[model samples]
Target: MNDQNNPRDAESDYADRIKLTVALLGKNNKASDVMLARQLGRNVLLEELGAIEEPYRALQPYEIDSNQRDNFAVHTREDIVMVYSLAVRANEQLYEIRSLVRILIALLFFLTVLFFISVIWR
Candidate 1:
């Protein structure tokens, strides 16, 4: 029988959620897969075993350069979630615009062909 008090058991229960959190953070931050993997590995070793807490810590400010430090924004999980959600919506909108442009181009081509045929027949 699995012991409920075991940290491994707790981690197992939240593994999917943790993976999802990491994936969303990676997408939002435009991180490479290898970078994301490394961060996830480090997080697993460093963080407490349970629910994924504050996955955006990787995005926190680092005092590497004064200019970079000035631009750093401290974000919470909710903030990251909002930013990711907005990005998804924007991407969907861009897809819709591209589809509409394709449809319009097709219609224009059909009209041009019809006009040319009519002029040639006359």
Candidate 2:
């Protein structure tokens, strides 16, 4: 059978082309960026970055993968950035929560000690 006719072969070919294209785009660029630019147009990519959004804009279906509904998929640079931003934000929030818990615990301990002292004095 011809390679084109086989689903596995076709997928492999597609992935190879993606890798080649990414390489040609230069080391700074990623496969996902090329896929997004091709699928969403270059303007959309710039526009999304320019827009004020926390973390980053949510990725569209086409931006995620040229071939949607496929089990295997590639990610865009924006997706990577967004995920990283989210992780950082989550980490920061966790630190804040921990600090708050610590403060609350200290206050509780102080209050308990004061209550016992007052009872003993009375």
Could you tell me every candidate's TM-score relative to the true structure?
0.40, 0.41
RMSD of each predicted structure: 12.1, 15.5
Model 2 per-residue lDDT tens digits across residues 1-122 = 11322323333434555566566665455665757346344333433432212113323323434354242233365567887999999999999999999999999999999999999999
Query: What shift in Å separates residue 81 of candidate 1 from its native position after superposition?
Result: 0.4
Clashing pairs in 2: none
* Model 2 regions more than 4 Å off: 1-75
**Model 1: per-residue Cα lDDT over 5-76, one tens digit each:** 433433543455457656676554546455555655555433432223433432454324654334333324
Candidate number of the best lDDT: 1
Residue 28 local lDDT, model 2: 51
Which one wins on TM-score? 2
Worst 10 residues of 2 by lDDT: 49-58
